[model samples]
Target: DQQVKQNSPSLSVQEGRISILNCDYTNSMFDYFLWYKKYPAEGPTFLISISSIKDKNEDGRFTVFLNKSAKHLSLHIVPSQPGDSAVYFCAARPVGADGLTFGKGTHLIIQP
Candidate 1:
């Protein structure tokens, strides 16, 4: 079963604008949320992570918000730049699970 879902296949944002990527999960046992950015011909790089117990976590230009009640999460990128364009994947790990479930990923295009 697809426990995690990234509803938008792609998102476009103007340079210097804010881009929001959304994700939803059906597994209530998930206790961790992670966002990864992937570029062509390269492996995904960890962007940020948040625990299910927390509502928000930030690291520089990246921020992740979790809503346990809603079983949803989002990644917000401010002042999007051309270099920020990539496929973003949302992943979640269950409370006692070692593996993570991932979404299909949403391609973010930062337009000039």
Candidate 2:
């Protein structure tokens, strides 16, 4: 069964606006969340991460929020730029698991 899911297949945001990407999980064992951004031909690079113990985490223009009760998480990018256009994957790791489960990913298009 798919543990992680990004309900929206794609999202479009105007430049300099806030872009919100959402994700949900069915596994209660998940204890960590990671957001990765991938370009057309490049490997997915880490964007930001948050632990289940916390509700939010931020890094520069990127922020990740986790809601254990709802089994949902989201990534927010403020002041979206042209270079922010890419595919974003939501990944989660279960307690004590060394590997991570990834969602299908959402294509974020930054319109300028």
Candidate 3:
């Protein structure tokens, strides 16, 4: 069974607006959560991360929220832009785990 899942296959947003992407996981052992942005053909690049102890983490225009009780997390992009258009994936790992569990990913389109 998939440990992490992205219920929405895609999302659309107007440029300069806010974009929200959500993910859910089944593993409570996951103590670290991360978001990765990917462009076609290129490998996913690190975006943001949140520790299990924290409910939120932010970087520049990107923010990540974690809700351990709900086993859920979300990524927020403020002032979404065309350049920010990409596949966003949610991933999680245990405190000492080597590999990460990733959601299928949500395709985001920033409409001009």
> Which residue ranges in model 2 land beyond 4 Å of their true spot?
none
RMSD of each candidate? 0.6, 0.5, 0.7
TM-score of every candidate: 0.98, 0.98, 0.97
TM-score of 1: 0.98
Clashing pairs in 1: none
Please estimate how well model 2 matches the true structure, expressed as its whole-model Cα lDDT: 0.96
**Runs with alpha carbons beyond 4 Å of true place in candidate 3:** none
User: Per-residue CA lDDT of candidate 2, range 1-112, in tens?
Assistant: 8899999999999999999999999999999999999999999999999999999999999999999999999999998999999999999999999998999999999999
- lDDT per residue, candidate 1, 1-112, as tens digits? 8899999999999999999999999999999999999999999999999997799999998989999989999999997989999999999999889998999999999999
> Residue 97 error for model 1, in Å?
0.9
Which of the predicted structures, 1 or 3, would earn the higher TM-score when compared with the native?
A: 1
Candidate with top lDDT is: 2
TM-score, structure 2 vs. true: 0.98
Per-residue alpha-carbon lDDT of model 3 for 1-111, expressed as tens digits?
999999999999999999999999998899999999999999999999999999999899999988889999999999899999999999999778899999999999999
